[model samples]
Target: MKQPTTDISSQQAEQLLQPINQFLQCRTPASWIEQAKQPQSLPILLKDHMVCELKAAQSAMLLIRRYAVDEDSGNALLQWLKPYEDFTYRLKGNWRDLADHNKLNKRMVPKSTKPYSQELIDKMVLLIKEELHHFYQVLEIAAELGVSYDRITSSRYARGLFTHVRTYEPAALVDKLICGAYIEARSCERFAAIAPHLAPNLGQFYFSLLRSEARHYQDYLSLAQQISDTDINPRVQFFAEAERALIESPDSDFKFHSGAPV
Candidate 1:
């Protein structure tokens, strides 16, 4: 697959990291960035970070359902996610319940003991755990800020990639994984891009996310490779083009994952 150019300059990266660091610093107080830097700010910054965690977990779950798991596992995955999705979309469920729900680990594998590999399961489990921890951290921050947990409308970022998923079986999975890789890569790039605009604490937080995001892109790509015997370069190119369109297009909504500022 064609790799996207990494022509961004060091100066540009530094500029981006500054704002992110500032954002983290200012997370506690309106002008915290200008004040003393302290360890106390971590909890506050982590509080708002929970949303990102949940979204990450949701993405991994979708991958497992669409590609790795059998039909029964797929249904189980949907059921497992119903509450979170409901809360996210404001369909039902109290947001507070998310805090108390059991963390997802050791997912139930089907009884068939088929030839299915556990690689996807292991990777996804770790991803889910990290995401939930991030979620918890964000909740803590929200609690500190006295910000009530409220459902917000989702941006078009995810839908844009998902819309391109093929309706067929394995092809659908291949396409989804390619899209997943793009999303993960984009997130990694954005974290690096936006870090400079943030405060010190925020910068560190976003920087910390880079490793996992990079790994996620690789994991998605690996999965795509495992499933397809044919060369996936063409499909990768197809999705890369789609992803670039989404990233470059004008989006009115300014979200963590949305395209360039409108």
Candidate 2:
């Protein structure tokens, strides 16, 4: 199969991702990324990445509820995720909730045909499943390393992009889709940037994430275009600038999505 054009040459990807790479290099003290390459860094990175997976799943669920699903389906989604959220928020849940043996293989039923399309459902479901799988993988890595899971404060990256979203309903959805594109794009870019700096196992893992991340960005952009009747170039450009600003800014936190190191 021919690869998509979105999968740019490594050189092109490097050039496009330079800004984020530079920001990470500037913000992350050299000692940190270097240490992260070590076996000891595995526990911390794995634990944090585990949390990131849950957050990613949560984000996808929010999007599906907000834009794709009708009221009934939205409620169903909330119920489906309640156990995971309870655990994440440190609330007690049933033993089944804690077991981690349940697999997310069920199909989602749309409440309304007006907003929900099969294509949209398929893409979002795939994204949600992958995110959840990544969550499980991170948990496995953490368990292997004897790392106790703990919740930490979220970085400002997501909020920064979301703050630009319009307050109106559909417009807000459009803006959010654009923002989602940028987030996925940046994640793909970062996976490439940090891949070479990581140890063999980690390097392979980051590389493996790149193809999916790139597809995710394209999926968001495609959805935005489908929802909007007209061309979405302006919206894309608007969010690209916003994303670049966020990437270039200085931030105190050193998360996977944080700005330049301070």
Candidate 3:
């Protein structure tokens, strides 16, 4: 995988992915990459990818809304996502309307009481911005390639990880952030693994995503560590095992993060 040459050198790409490669338990199986590049899978891939971008943004927004922002800011965040939600859920809006709604008003007042959680406001807010922008970019890519965005189901990857989330407090938040790290790390891995096999433009797009997704993994990990009162190493290891199982086990649903195809 030495391409994405226009954006960065292969040596740089390898260096960029080194931490992500070290973090994850396995490489994406060649079969999965082959599956992803199939012509029949392209529309499904683009549609689900578009949804994933929105979902990523939504999760980041939820973190800021529930744990960091003032109520008004939370409401503002909701409105920011409404157009996207409407399109995904109700099929009510067009892609053209989405861009106008991506920006959050400068009213994200931090809560004085939850000083620690306030840290989430900045990182998660940046994630929200970039992810929503990604959602738009994916929509454009899909349209350009004549792929129609439609209703698509999720793979078991995220649900499987979330099942391990603790039924408790900051611990739960820590677990969620850990899960976020794995998800981001895996996305980064898959993007690199499959990029070389895609059309040049799409390959470049996926390649361009590598740095941000890698940074997202690190950000999620740092947040998990920062928010945890106790050592998060054991928990991180625990989730790593869980994520590994999800990635290596047999799976029928094939989406961006699905494991082995049945």
Summarize candidate 1's per-residue lDDT along 54-172 as a digit string, tens digits: 77788888767655677777677666666766765564776668666535533556334423347777677677766665565555545645665665556677788889888986788
Q: Provide TM-scores for the models.
A: 0.70, 0.78, 0.95
Off by over 4 Å in 1: 1-52, 70-87, 91-102, 105-107, 110-116
lDDT of each: 0.61, 0.65, 0.84
TM-score of 1: 0.70
117-224 per-residue lDDT for model 2 (tens digits) = 556667876886676665655555456556766666777877888898989856777788788777777777666756677655556566666666767777888888
Sort order, TM-score high to low: 3, 2, 1
Looking at model 3, the pairs that clash are none
Lowest lDDT 10-residue stretch of candidate 1: 23-32
Error of 1 at 69 (Å): 3.9
10-92 per-residue lDDT for model 3 (tens digits): 67779889999899888888778888988888787788887888888888888888888788999999988888999997889
Q: By TM-score, is 2 or 3 better? A: 3
TM-score of structure candidate 2: 0.78
